[model samples]
Target chain A: MELPGIAFYIVAFLTMGGIYAILCLALNMQWGFGGLFNAGIAGFYAVGAYTAAILTSAGSSAHLGGFDLPIVVGLICAGIASGIVGWAIARICVRLKADYLAMASIGIAEIIRLAIVNEEWLTNGSLGISRIPRPLEAFYSGRAAEVVFVVFVWLIVAVTFLVARRLQQSPWGRVMRAIRDNEETAASIGKDVQRFRTETFVVGSVFMGVAGALSAHYFKFFSPDATEPLLITFLAWVMLIAGGSGNNLGAIAGALAIWAIWSLTEVVTQQLPPDWATRSSYIRMLLIGLLLQFVLQRFRSGLFPEKSPKLRISREK
Target chain B: MIDFINFYLIPGITLGSIYALGAVGVSMIFGILRFAHFAHGDLMTVGAYAALTAVWVLGIPALAAIPFAIIVTCLAALLADRLFYRPLRDLPTIYTVIASFGVALILRSIVQTVWGTDSQVYMTGFQKPTIFFDTFRIATRHIQIILATAALTVALHYFLSRTRLGKSMRAVADDPDLAAVAGLDTERIIRWTWIIGAALAAIAGVFVGLDTDVHTNLGWNLLLPMFAAALLGGIGKPLGAIAGGLIIGIAEEACTYPFFGDTLIAPSYKSAVAFVIMVLILIYRPQGLFRGRLM
Candidate 1:
């Protein structure tokens, strides 16, 4: 490919990877730090994307739209919307076992997808609520626009990464890890384990919502198909797990790596005839699944497992 | 009244039976294996396709292909146990569940690759429902599904409660440490559990193909509902799965009841009903209606 073409594709891929990295960090907060198994990652993501779209889109008047809100307000509200939904889910599912929590999470995601498909008033039905405002699009176009979006997404990713890092080093983060390491012990020591877990879940969901809003603005066009579990939710888990569950930097690395793999697989599989394309994609899915297995078996702590604070402190002494 | 039975009751029972079969397998795995088998639904699809292939290659009828498919699924389950579950035995339950999710994706992709995305029917063309009692009606396939579920349930009950092997299996589920200490072959018992549970999942998938159509996503769509059934029926009790499946199946159909205090709900919302019930059960009755696992 020519330099300009390559540059455009690279910019596009980086923006997507940055957006995914934000999501991975959010998930790490729940699964890694809080020991919560949130399988319904896509539901919170959809909540963010749709909420932002509804708040900002000028064309959507029949439903909850035409507010024409600023992009920042829309983005913040998207986060709030996702967090609220996560809080509700946490109330019902947090007391259950790990397996049950996972089940409820996946169920919530499917329900969200179904609701989006059916509720024309809320989501514009299957046609999907388009015309979501893209930030800074007035000044840039084509390759330039995409490059600006990449910078825009990276700014958000960097901010989220810093906040997540601060949280990881805080006493609150210690309590979170304590709960994950041993819930019984944490409870015995007077920690409100369940409450903290719920908080972590909500906090994590906020970032997911932010990522969703970013994704919506980037594509400027999305349908229910964009929220499919295989493409969005499961991929997030794979990124988090492959990168090192508790490590933020690892999350970023995993996001880029997995996104690369995803796009490359599509490119490789696209060579097939029209009839065989579907089969090839399935084969690609199979490969991705096997890759996850390999990662789980070999890299149990993930590629960049969490650094033990205690170990670091003692070593310094 | 006949319309209610024909539209809701009959379809509910048929769906319930399919779920009951898969739920039994899921519940058994949770009880004995002590992890949620995420791949159970995909395995069901694999079984259906296996049977579909048998019918195609051997030029046999649909019903006749079932046994061969069951055997193949059994072996597949055994292979999965050895290849996936065995390696992660010592890990936490969550890890095993994640592994099962991986297995599910793998199985689904294989089905998509081999069968392509187009929906397939075993007999092609719809079979008209047969009238019963001059007022009630159900398709012939529905009756077969109900009868087959009943037979499987009875046989499973007999084995679990009556035969020595069945008792031993129950004993293992109740207290694996004790069963192991008492000289029972726990590994062999687990192997049998996988074989039986997986064969049952296969039959459920095949029955679905018989009633509706076979597609790559068939089992994926059923995964959550059957899980709800298994959880509702209690963790390990096969009988509970049947009852739970029936309730969930019926509840799903009723979710679209045109009048909801003068409001309307689309039928597309039917699937969410199962999920809502599952969440409620997890909150209010985690031990399940059958009182199996204490969640």
Candidate 2:
């Protein structure tokens, strides 16, 4: 490939990796700090993507769309929509044990998926929405457009990182960690553990929504297939666990590292014989699953373990 | 009324039998191991494909392939435990859950790679259902599935209430700490739990294949309803799971029936019935109908 082509590939990689980073950060808030097991990241993601798709896309008779709103409004609406779903789910299932919560969340995600596929009047059924507009697409074209999107994605990642870091250091974050580490202690201290968990779940879901919208805009299309749990929810979980659950920096690193593995495997698998092409995807899935097992078995703390800040004390002693 | 029995009720009972079989395993594992075994659906897939393999290679009847399926799936489940779950046994349940998710992926992918993705049936041609008193018609496989499930339930009942191992298994599921303190072998109980769960799951898988064509997503698609049945029955109660499965299965099929004039729900949304039921149960009766464990 030529220099421009290589550059474009890198741009695409960063764009996707950056979006996954946002998802990882959101998940960090929920599972990493809050000890809430939400296995329905894909549902909130779909809500955001579809919300943005409906709000921003040009009017169409095929499904619900035509607001032609600005991308920023669409993104904001996506976050709100996703956050609402997260809050609803959290309200119902947050108090359950981690395993039960996970099962309930998965059920919700499946229901969301069913609605997406069956509600033709709203989401165009399985056909999905098309022609989703990218940010600043009118001002740039071709290679330049790709670079602009990559930069845009990275900017959001930076903002997400800083926000997540701030939340981790905040008093509220401390309360969340306390609740996660020991719910009884936190509740005894009048911390209201359930409320904090619900709050964290909503906060994390909002980021996931934004990430989903970003992907929609980047692809310029939205489909039910894109909202698959394996790609969105499961991948995000792997990234968070692989990177380091509680550490924001590890989230980004894990996203990039895992995303690299996910994408590059396609390139290598494509080199196989023609008959082997169809089976290669399964091979990739197998490899990824094995990698998760290895990580879970060997590196429970992940790549970057959470480092608690040292308390500053007076010199009276 | 005849139409209801023929088109809806009989099929519902058959489907419910399959769900009950699968849910028994899920409930036992959930109660005993204290983690949702996400790979369970895939284990069903493995059993179905294993049975399919037996049919193709041995040129035997699908029903006859049940033993082969049981053996293969039991081995798969035991191996999965030894390799992936045992190491993480001491960690938080969340880690095991995640590992099981990974295991689900691995199992499904392996099936896809080996069997190919296309849906296949044990026997290509359809069989005529035998009619009873020239009023009701029921398929042979449906009768087999329902009867097989009933027999298994009886056997399971005796095992749980009669056998020493079964009693110990129940004891452990009821209270692991107390069971340990009482000198019951925890590891032995865990192994029996896997065996019983996997054995039922394999039978359920073969039943699903018997009912419809076998495909890669065959088991994955039915996972929600199985979990719903398990939750509805109560986490630790096998008998309750059977009742829950029947209720859910009947409800799912019956909801699509047109009562007043038009269909109550769109056929596409039938799957959501299980999820709705599960959420409601969780809100109203988390301990399940059998008054099982709260945790």
| Candidate 2 per-residue lDDT over residues B1-295, each given as its tens digit | 8998988998999999989988998899889998888898899999999999999999998899999999999999999999999999998787899999889899999999999999999998878998999998999998899899999999999999999999998898899999999999999889989998998999899999999989988887878899899999999999899999999989999999998889889989998999999989888998999987777
Model 2 chain B weakest lDDT span, ten residues long: B215-224
DockQ per model, Cα: 0.81, 0.84
Position A227, candidate 1: lDDT: 55
**Fnat values, candidates in order:** 0.87, 0.79
TM-score for chain A, candidates 1 onward in order: 0.95, 0.96
Best by TM-score: 2
Models 1 onward score TM values of: 0.96, 0.98
Where model 1 places Cα greater than 4 Å from the true spot, the runs are A271-275, A310-317, B257-265
Q: Identify the runs in model 2 with alpha carbons over 4 angstroms from their true place.
A: A311-317
Q: With candidate 1 superimposed using the best TM-score fit, by how many Å does residue A183's alpha carbon deviate from the native?
A: 1.0
| TM-scores of chain B alone in all candidate structures, in the order given | 0.96, 0.99
